[model samples]
Target chain A: MSIPGIRDRKIEDVGLQAGVDRLTEDQIQKTIKKVLKGETGAKLKLYAETCMRCGLCAEGCHYYMSHDKDPSYAPVSKVRQTMWEILRHNGKVSPEFIYGCAQIAYTECNMCKRCAHYCPLGIDIGYIISVVRRICHKLGVVPLYIQDTAHSHSATMNQMWVKDDEWPDALQWQEDEARDEIPNLRIPLEVEGADIFYSVIGPEPKFRTQLIYQAAVLMNETGQSWTMPATPGWDNSDMAMYTGDYEVMGRIKRAHFDTAMRLKVKRIVMGECGHAFRSIYDMGNRWLGWKMHPVRVMHAIEFYHELLEKGQLKIAKTFDTPVTLHDPCNIIRGRGLMDQAREVVKAFCPNFVEMTPNREHNYCCCAGGGVINCGPPFKNVRVEGNKVKAEQLIRTGVPVVIAPCHNCHGGLEDIIHAYKTGQELKFLIDIIYECMEKPDAVE
Target chain B: MNAAYEFVVGPLAWIAGAIFVLGSIYRLVSMYALAVKKDYSSLPYMDLKYSLRSIIHWLNPFGTAGWKASPWTAAVTFIFHICLIITPLFLLGHAVLLETFHGIEWPTISDGLADGLTMLVIAGCIFFIIRRATVDKLKYITSGMDWFVIFLVLATFLTGFAAYHQWLNYQFILILHILAGEAMLASIPFTRLSHMIFWVFIRGYMGSEFGKVRHAKDW
Candidate 1:
């Protein structure tokens, strides 16, 4: 699925190409050998040897479905093209092969883990692809945009490379905007012993500042005790884990957990971003070898569900527009929040029509797993690759799609625009903020 | 020709059995040790409750949505595995041989039933081979080794059937049958056939990761 007249077709990752070119043959060989032998354990051995390659997983992949059943996009075939090739050559593959591996592992597959559900033996192709990413990363071969985001995590302790002072400035802007509405709402900052430590991805400050305003409004209206850190550790979005830079991923997680621990908050409430939730709750903490995170954390979906279930945030009027919920893989499949997401959506927007194959079986946005973060070079493929998802949207026939994850919002927005599906994308918090009643008089 | 037949049925069978048992043991122990030493995270959250639930769902035919979605593949796979295990264990010839060698006795399927099941195994292999070859989506993953494995199983069951029916060259087919069965046995620990043993690790650990770690039902 290439756009015509574009030379930058076929997943042209210049950074990956450059990195592969800079590597000596010996470096590539040794790096692959070292990673394959040292890092992977029985998990890799079990998955590799146990796979029978029945191709049952092809039906589960949006890429395969959208591309007219191309065998190359099958989850196991992606592994064959990468891991099997490395094993076949005993780590002596050419630079061009490594570049191809990086493209397929990093961009083509979303790593959403949906196919794992389809696999009869539950072989995690996502794990194998990540292992390939780990190998490419060690060889300094990675997609340009995602690698740059990981670098930002290293330098700024944030994915967007938001400047130090600008972080709080954005919050101040939101707090003031919210106060104009509430007359007394102040986004609490650095509140010690607060019940909740609210954090968001850097995008809120960089571009989507209105999300911060909406979240602030929700917090005030609910009469919740919450604080946003006026510091670098506030941003929870992570690209390091996606890029297979676990060392940087661990550092970012530490900063986030440490910030919450320092504030003595009872829990950390992250904004609507699926990868950020995954990094903090599932992957980053696991890499740090923490049996449990120092502070309890929940995604915005869980938070909104909790608030709505307890009648803490009451609705003034049910949403008028018909809407469908897009279950982000990290939360629905990775965390089993499918029921809660549906409950929250149905409560506010009663005109809910579920897309076919909803819940854990839903197709990925094709932009997640850092494909969207890979930026404009991959945008065409990202949209075209998930025509199945666009069709899913069209099937729902809803004017709006509510995705509880920021990355899904970004991903779905692009598809809607490109496909001309004419569906507006909104966060769950956005819809709730609109329909939920604010206090009649400010405190 | 007598020497070759005796070698396959006697010494080769013994060698294959020893390797099958010992190699399988070695693989399991090494894999368990590796998990303990390197992948400690995989061990901690393996809740028996979730793991067993996940395993039970996968163990049942049409237990998962994916299995239910593609009924033909699931049916073929389940029947193939069932026949592969049941035919060899319950065949009257195998039971008598075990009783003579190890002084043990167990009820076996009648000769006619074993013949039918053996044909089913061969038919299953043929079905898989044809599916892999003709199905466009399976082309990328259908390796030379996949063909070799399917051919190995087909040859085992095919020759067993021929020797039973006393078809052309009965003595030669009998020898071929013994050798192919033994090759499949020795391959159990070294090749993808090892999946028979490690499904607990791949499917079970995945079950645990999804059910216990991620709190989602993998199946």
Candidate 2:
């Protein structure tokens, strides 16, 4: 029932102790209390008291079903570990308990909020867990690797430590690279008042710069009025979502919005990222006390759908494969965009297999909500824990898995690789790039 | 020892003690059986890693991790719960009843701890109510059931304190407080308070699931 490639490496054994050197119990307690007293703490209190324990959330959770019908792995149990225990004990539990709470709050759960979809009562266990993370961040119990990313986010406004001077250079690099495939391709940087404010996570600049290159080629072919940011706010990836550091999470979001506002763009068009979308819409913006976002946000899938539907982008060829889509919890469950993503998929791929309980009910990639970002020590558990997801994919027997969110893409890469399911994970744009009928071919 | 002639004391004592024991046993039995049927699994080894992280988590209790998760909310909410728990079992009335019935007069906390725990319960309830009102994300999630639970707790705490302090001679307040206490205990087997007994198992189960994912036993 498990994937062969999944390694049993324990994240704790992998130098997590190095991050443990600086922290002390008193400092962690102080940090935990501070976060609880802040806006995030208040949110946790509200979510905890509201859950009626209806167990409707069971079906929405992959872990719950993945473990052969264990009711405890249900998403609600995830909240119970952190919030309910804190509620029952009056904050007097030992540090060992807090550690368990930290892992459950941050790594084990993906904060996809799909369970909220299944709940008639609309209980958001993901929000409850994020609040737990907010508390954990304050306590300094966060895994060191993930914490470093947050530090990078705070310092560079990107998670991957991409240097300031390197951003525009990278964009130029991608544009130059893209010209090999499309001679007229360009990656527009800092074009004020452009119709689209194109944003991406630090991974784009750091590791998968080719995605940027691909986007540039697509944008060039479509002649889209897109602009990339030259400044610190260019990164749409918010590590605050993972750290549970709501205050920092809020600041990052405000920075992102202010950056967009300064540019006077109509709306932000983000690359494939689920958690970033959630941070902007669900966790961060709400922490800032806004009922709704003033500036609109669009996922890459929805944005591509608009472009294709409006004749802004043209297809080169129909992707001929039995490709299954892994709905990023942020986009599908958090934002309710299952149909649009499917529509975009149908337009490109000739054969699409829908996973059971597809769309908004899709399971998290086990890498989101900062879980994958939590570091390599906990990687084995994350991979092993996603047996249900692997099974879901295996049952579908699809050769390709398209995950539009960056975290999902990263996490899925690990999951698919670990399971050795021979499944190729991809961003929807990759398919669009391959399947879109060339302009010359159409002529 | 002189129980044969004293009908009210001996027979009623036996009845109350029996109900207390049998009812609690029944509740525990039913919960355990339900849990067994549902197959509440054990935590895996990865949970141990999480537990190990607690060494560092406890290092900075004031930071986010220490205070963010359950036991904190549970701590406050349960402070109220613990007060409700201790007060009912060790109150002057309960002491007198137990002395007459079960023949056990438990040593009590200082009057200060008693009153402090009560005030603590009140503060916890107030904190919960205010949080529901103020936080926008929380406000959307709050239900009428939540409000009812809050108000019910306030009534129980306020009335019990009033009776305990002798500020209310209105047998009404004392009687209502007693009824609420009894009702709450009975409801424990059915309502959300059941989470008190079940969350440990649930959390342990959740903790273990990660191990299966990690390909190790739960921490």
Candidate 3:
């Protein structure tokens, strides 16, 4: 049941090359049957049985809309192409079929769950797509870059393969960088029983080390007791969860929680990352058999909101440039931080204008859900799929786009370049750093 | 009564009704019985009040926040469901049938209103069928069962309309109408139409998940 021309687009990436080797038909069938029987439950059955194919979900999907209303891109069509085939064949499908499922589940869909909101039946299409990814993961068929990232998670306990020495070195380096601004500043490393255990994704240390400096300055300015682990658990990002490797997901989450518990922190305050927030607060915790995180988890938005509300962080000047906010889907839709995020933005930027279809209804930056982790090989697909988003940003006519999530920042960076929108993407913290009054300077 | 009428309008009617009730209950119970992991996350936003309010809010197609996302579909669907339910329950002929079978009667709508409502239902079915056939995205996802359900509802309404006007071979048309109605009743729990009962649980669970667990205002 190979889709014509679909295989032609396959990229030659190391992870894809290593992982997606042809499997025996029997192996494929057995794996599919096992997952379908074990993973799927009442909700899956109800969603499958109840969808009326009304196509209302089509309007909600940015991919479908962006792709000229391509039928194959529709959320329900994605389900029919992947999950229904498994059900219809009773898992007797071919390796070719599994490959196609991997592509759709991993590459095409962001698993943002916006379609679930528009569904009259409230079918969580994202969950269904993730189930397909799980099956693909079992079949050893996942996107190259993301699977490689997952391998990093398995080996290094982080996505970027940041080693023990590198983690501490990067922190120390950032601490020195921050001290240039505030002479007495320090990026506290593993201060046990700190009120806040601040974790960040791997990229902060690897490529975006400046973000760590900004966070340090903000923390010092606020006089908040926050310590970052000089270990693997500092990377809150999880590509394994997106790739449907739940075992690796659970392990990564366990290490993260274990790190927090070891530090005896009262709560974990994560940097501005949407999927990481979803992973810690929702998916990863649930996978580890805890109904919730053992320690309270707060996104940077919530933390910022609290700081502002408590008058701990005061804005010395409002951002002069007219700026627009990009609501990261995981935080806005996955958690209800829409109002809080806007309030924080308004505190710094008085000239804040909203993008059309803002908040929970906002379009995904199309980079989260590990799509960006699919990496450079799938760059064109990622950029093309986010045509709607590019248009949405272009419509705002604002120079700067405040994308709070790490992945959204990456995705929007690509979109801005590809679409030639001339829009600069900044994190909320970027503006906060610029506008907040320095505590040492005030005296 | 003729044997044909007796079989369809009498004993078969009771069988359909029984299947409709018991089958629907079985489906609902089995679905709810499916193991669900409890969400132990502390509520950031507790709004059981708004969760219930959202159920009613979503029912009003124009009123909900999602209306902006898919306005036309929402409007058409809202109207279609309203006409579909009202025409069957409050039609003069259906009231008479209910009184004859179960010795129960409710106020009936005027024949003119019932006729207009029936026409609206027919139009809705046609719109659905055409949309499934013509909308590229919809056409791909639509299964035989999807079209079959639409055809089945159309048949019921068409035959009932024909039987009401006494258009050619009244008895035969009436029998076809009853059989079509019975088929719809028997299939409700098994088909996509089961959303009628499942909608409560689905929408309620989603509302609670968003409103309480995730702490998002979905509406």
Candidate 4:
């Protein structure tokens, strides 16, 4: 039996609902108008017109190489197909163009901004793609599951429809479970005026709550002043941002920042996430019209570096397993945190091998940039699109892979399993806490 | 000069220039038609406030305006591209042509700059090709057409520099040089290379549309 047949065996394979899946030419034009209207505002014009396609960006893209060197896979070409065509034709392009734009913006590409590293002109192709996604979202042509996740972001302030009470309850539950590893661990919720506000996405409450517990254990053991919110603002992850639902994205970002402000924290120390960091640092903060983020946001990698650098967190034992780091584009390329992450890894693990072209030039997990969340129908493209990443992992010859960002971790897992890389993937926080001494175990 | 060389170099140059102009006009006109049909409007100035504020971004050491999207890659790639463009146009043979036609002589660079630029272009191309081959998502986007273009460029640059060195010591090397340069010009309008010129207009139009959408202008 073929791979599709095997996949079909796992689920009832009703194909995509026909007719409704495609948009009409007239509808596409209408969507273009609506998108233009919605996207109309201050600060977007600079974003729209700044691209210079030197193709220096070819180096940062995974899809471009993954799909047999299709120029359409290049981030610049993706923009060309949608925004460039719109400019060339002045918006008379068909709905099919919009459909293509939807796929390129939402599914085909991950808005990782790694290409930005190669672009001499520094055209934020990822930003341009996200804008295209925002337009597609307003046009009502986004893939169903991703759009549904965005709806959850709007309604519940979380992507998984996790309620407010469930958020705190999940964190408390994780704290309880962590006590087995280290006795008397407390995952404090809603503490006011804390120095650090640790924010996580909805998955912690919905599926991986133990991560929240792990984070709590690490935070407390490091003796950091941190707190998790007990309200709708707890989730810093924004699927709405990925799905191009700008209005909802604005809401989520606003709530997140407001919650941080309400707590009067020095900065937001986010859990292991890439898109969420991109949202807070790159997208969401900009949507709120701030020149710089009102609340300083740090990924878990940055926070860990800070803790270790200040000698606030001490590693009692070095993790003995050989490991490779999957550089999260947002943290590495966007924020220049790759060196810091490596420093943290070196402090925790005795055996660490750098992936080829690690740091700013790292390959995307192929699932990120909104590709993984696009829906199951596109899974074939997502998995097959990352064969090169699998090959890279195979070459590393390491048993453990540390992916700091949640989205990258999820996406990497899918690719690893699909290609059977036979490696265990863990969050940076997981390994950090595991290797650190308990508060009482200190010398 | 022999009439054949004159015809090939002069009239061919004219034809290449004409084709380049005509092809560019056609692409721009078609693009404009599409934008107009879509009611594409130039973004108002207020929307591009950041782009406006950073006027010197384009003139920076590494094309800072473009690099705002990506600083590190932009710096290195920009430097390499500069060498790629400058080395070809400023080669000794190119200087001879300019001295013959335009009556101007640029100060000759030490062989260091010449060889350095050649190596830079080679390295840049190699880096790009390796990236296209190694990265998964990028591999998906790497089509045969793109590879052909890059490979042709690599061959052109490599062979041109080799011919300059007179390594092969063959008349065919000069012919190859002229042929590659002419072929690159001819291919520009039809291939993705058209993106070089079209992107400006497209970017402007996109900036304007985003302005209209964002209710601001000047991006």
Candidate of highest lDDT? 1
| TM-score, second chain, candidate 2 | 0.66
How many Å off is the CA of B52 in candidate 3?
A: 2.4
Report the error of model 1 at residue B65, Å. 3.0
Give me the TM-scores for chain A across all models, comma-separated.
0.96, 0.90, 0.97, 0.89
lDDT of 2 by residue, A307-352 (tens): 8889877776788879999987777755667788899999888799
Candidate 4, DockQ to 2 decimals?
Answer: 0.07
Residue-pair clashes, model 1: 1
Estimate the overall C-alpha local distance difference test score of candidate 4. 0.70
Better of 3 and 4 by TM-score: 3
Q: Which stretches of candidate 4 lie over 4 Å from their true place?
A: A1-24, A33-56, A180-183, A441-443, B1-219
List, for all models, the DockQ compared with the true complex.
Answer: 0.73, 0.03, 0.50, 0.07
Can you give the lDDT of residue B150 in candidate 1? 88
Better of 3 and 4 by DockQ: 3
The TM-score obtained by model 2 is 0.65
Off by over 4 Å in 1: A1-9, A440-443, B1-4
Instruction: Candidate 3: give the TM-score of chain A.
Output: 0.97
Residue B215 lDDT in model 4? Answer: 21
Q: Can you rank all candidates by lDDT, best first?
A: 1, 3, 4, 2
Candidate 1 per-residue lDDT, tens place, A1-443, comes to 11111213356678887898898778889999899888888888788777888988888898888888777777887888888878778888878778878888888888999898778877889989999999989989998999999999999999888999999888888888777788888889999999999999988899999988888888888989999888889989889998889899999999999999999999999888899988888888888888766689898889999998888989988987999988899988888899998998888887999998888888899988998988888788788889999999999998999888888888889899888999998888888888889994263
Q: Which candidate is the best by TM-score?
A: 1
Error of 1 at A68 (Å): 0.4
